[model samples]
Target: MAKIEPGNGLTSAVSRNILRGTTESLALTDGEGNSFGSDSELNAYTSERQTDKYGFIGGAQQYSEQSAENIPPEVLRQREAKWLDMLNNWDKWMAKRHKKMKLRCQKGIPPSLRGRAWLYLSGGKVKREQHKGKFEELDSQAGDPKWVDVIERDLHRQFPFHEMFVAREGHGQQDLYRVLKAYTLHRPEEGYCQAQAPIAAVLLMHMPAEDAFWGLVQICEKYLPGYYSAGLEAIQLDGEILFALLKRVSPLAHRHLKKHNMDPILYMTEWFMCAFSRTLPWASVLRVWDMFFCEGVKIIFRVGLVLLKCMLGSQDKLKTCQGQYETMELLKTIDTRYMQEGFLVREILELPVSERDIEKEHLASVRRWKETRGELHCKALPRMHGAKAIMAAEPPSRQDLRQNPTIIVELPLATKSNGEDKERKKTKEEKNGKKNSSPTPVVADLEPSKPPPPLKDTALLGSNQSLSSTEHDTYL
Candidate 1:
């Protein structure tokens, strides 16, 4: 096979290392099939280089981890304890003390707890439990050839510079492959989009493959339906909403866009699709995600607006960008000053972009699109906004905590054939009079015993399938 190099507008410098020689590196295998290389090899390469906390090999190391490191260890322990308590009683905090939850999220979930917090926040834990073994089943099956081929090609392209994905066909890339390919199998209609690679790569960085797969599921189906779907109609609608909101949030920037006839799609596609994983500094990306999994897609909008405001909100700032190309370039290569986590997170939280505001614009945009362009090709399901809404729709139970603990573990595959295996084990246990060893069966906890009172801010919108439901277990 011919060697594929970086700078082809396809692969990256790190990926070039993987694609360097013979067809051997390109060959696929069953499990852990990426080319063999040692982390020691990658480490030696970066030994003299400056790497940020997330372990990207090089660059200016734009985001600082020193602030987090500089904190007293005791303070770090205290934060971890607080996060632990919150995770232990997540439903209570979500149901009543969501304001405090939001406050904690803004402060930033402890890095150690970030993965579990995200799983809980996105309701992926519930989805994972409700459909146990689903990921393994999908992993076992051969996915659509078309999607599988595309996914294989795109795996190395995601976060190629980061240690997790730096090695050729390393564990990081393997796990990333499993999550992305599993998603394609789970939601064949949506299939694979190149942008999802980075999103899944980020998730895998923080969580195990199964947990990461469910997290990706929640993102595609519950959080941003129609986003990765055919025609990407939902994103197009969101882009319009972002542009309309920009008119109010930053008129100068909005006018600058209008003056140049710059459509949001021209610049915002990668930003929105990847949720700024590719755009923002590493620390800033995590900060945004800390809120995003808790607050939903509105956080994405706020971050984008903040970037617009910082970059072109003023006449003076806009003066240098007189043409579309300059404006595009500025948006593409965001100023590092605005990329700092503290400044970026502060601006994002301070911005008054409410959920209602986004929904209102969405309604208007959808109506306008229908009147002008007719119905969209893809029909997106309505989604709960964030942790609060997701929890509101399907209240977690004490029994659930006992049965499905938050700590990551490989769940038993809940397939029909596995049911027989479970029965056999149950029968043997019963003969031995070890019935008590089995977990106590609880009443169906899909719907809360009492419906949660409506939230003050905005009403929860149920997706076509509730996160707690088992009917569409295949999807999540």
Candidate 2:
């Protein structure tokens, strides 16, 4: 096996051949000793596999069906144990063991535990419980007819290679429709956006429809709020931020792109909006989502920066590219072999970028964008030309709070055993002179003051407790 060192360009024919061979080794097969030659072939084979095995009634197979089997047994056990521990003592684990959690997330959440872990990490469980039956309520109503056609058209386009979304009327696509429609009803202001389709599809792969819906809500509201809204103002602003970060991180590549009059929006809109779902390999996409849920949107920016550097950093690769079209083509079709899941994750984790760094750049970028807006006579920005600009001047309103309910653990006002209600009824009867009844003794409640019981193995599998912000904010 040959090692392709970082910074060594992939322009060499030998290196390219090695890369191609490695990629083919990971390609999907038709289970009859045949391999797919192209993405369409792979999709057709997987869709046929789904029909042959489970018919079209259930969800199609996931993109990376062998993802779990590829993990070493020892690693799998270790991750499973950690997942169980997190489940049993979720609050304490999230609060105290977050560094360990982040490290584990970087390694990769086990496929079996990914849904639960993501629900916990993204505060989805909290939101789900808070808005119980909300999806049913939303699903009962028809969404804005305007978004129905757009959502339906983009349904199959998301993860067309994945078995889950292969059939237009498959369980996966039906669930996807429900989730997207629920969201539009949940947040009528934002309605439906094309970029959200892939995001929801990926979520459906990991969790059920209702859970996926809440996960999407958490993402749009907490993780990347304004990015998918009508105007995509946040995305436009982040494009400038990404460009500024690129200039700092890879000045040479930045200069090359600028020289050719290439704009950040030219290549980064889908990348940012989809959170790399469409850009990275399915395996890499899962790993990135692990970190994205734990750390905020900074992960997206960092991954974007690293990708830019990988594609355009090498002088050898850039020298051959003549102009914006060539550069854009190169970027759009960058080889995934170079970005193998493990290597790409390691690179992203090792980057010197931080949340604080992104925040600083974001502030500056917003300022620059505002200045540019002023210069354009306060006209709609170029990015807003095609997209509707719902959020034009003011910041996103408090009404967004309604879209994603805050995490609230509703404690019972009084325990049934306490008989507080009984005592109230007795007092009212005595006041009315309707009956003479003894008042039930009030039991002093000490449960609130008592420390939580030690976690036991028996409690590992069925914990439904929602972690407080104290547990989440430390790392996220």
Clashes of each: 0, 0
Winning model by lDDT: 1
Off by over 4 Å in 2: 1-69, 375-476
- Residues 1-476, candidate 2: write the lDDT tens digits: 02223432223432332222222222433344233334465456655554321122122223443322267877776777667567545565555777787788878887766876787677676676666678888988888887776677556555544555554465666778889999988988677877788789888777777888888887787677676654455666778888988898899889998998776766787688778876676677788888888776778888888888988998888876889778877886776654567668878888887767777887787677667663212122223110012122112323321222222333344444658887886687778886744444433221223423332333212122222322331111
Query: Whose TM-score is greatest here?
Result: 1
Give per-residue CA lDDT, model 1, range 1-476, as digits (tens): 01122322222422332223212223321246443245566667668666676666654333466323245767766777787678767777877889988988988877767877888899888888778799989989888888888788766556655666767667777778888889988987677877788789888778778888999988887778777765656877898999999999999899889989887776777778788877777787888899999999999999989999899999888889999889977886778878887788889989999999999999999999899888776778786688888777877666554333321223343444677888887797789887555343333222223322332463224211112222221111
Can you give the TM-score per candidate against the true fold? 0.76, 0.67
Candidate 1 wrongly placed segments (more than 4 Å): 1-43, 60-70, 403-476
- Give lDDT: candidate 2, residue 364: 88
Lowest summed lDDT over 10 consecutive residues: which window, candidate 2?
A: 384-393
The true-versus-predicted C-alpha distance at residue 205 of model 1, in Å, is: 0.7
